[model samples]
Target: GSRGSRGSRGSRGSRGSRGSRGSRGSRGSRRSVGHVGRVCQAGPTPSAKASSRASSRVDRGLSQ
Candidate 1:
């Protein structure tokens, strides 16, 4: 099946003519780091998560 990949840009790279999915839910290192409860670039680390969630909700056209 043709889909997204989850590996990195290594020297050898992936093989076998197959790859992993690239969905956000499948990313092991996924961390919502952005403007959540505060300014994404300037807010404290704590507020960043909140700001990011807020942003994602808005991005998805969902009411926050």
Candidate 2:
């Protein structure tokens, strides 16, 4: 009974860490998106190109 409880607790702890890592990754991506948006807003001609590149990057990220 002790061993079983320990195993379950270990699994839960690992899962929690994984969830935290995922959240951090999502936050990082959001930061990148915001930075890109700001840069895009700073110019007109480059904005269209940057937007296309950003969309492609988002697609790639989603695919992963």
Candidate 3:
């Protein structure tokens, strides 16, 4: 009946919950980036130099 069709729309609410989880995941990634930036700043190893440049690019991107 019409009620059965209406029930399908309830599934859309689950998508909204997933959106919040995605935001939390973004926050986690930003924290990891910050940690990497600190390590790059503290000790400039060969690999850290590359990470430093990448982090600089990220900063510029954020600024622009």
How many clashing pairs does model 3 include? 0
**Model 2 segments beyond 4 Å from truth?**
32-64
Ranking by lDDT: 2, 3, 1
Models sorted by TM-score, best on top: 2, 3, 1
CA-only RMSD, every prediction: 12.7, 10.3, 12.7
**Candidate 2: clashing residue pairs, number:** 0
Residue-by-residue lDDT tens digits, candidate 2, 1-60: 999988986876566545654565577567767766677667545654575466555544
Residues 1-64 of candidate 1: C-alpha lDDT, one tens digit per residue: 1233334223113321112222332342245433233355564665545654654444344311
Q: What residue pairs are clashing in model 1?
A: 35-51, 35-52, 36-50, 36-51, 36-52, 37-50, 37-51
Better of 2 and 3 by lDDT: 2
Give the winner by lDDT: 1 or 3: 3
The digit string of per-residue lDDT tens for model 3 on 1-64 reads 6877666545544443445445544664577567767787766366545754565555445433
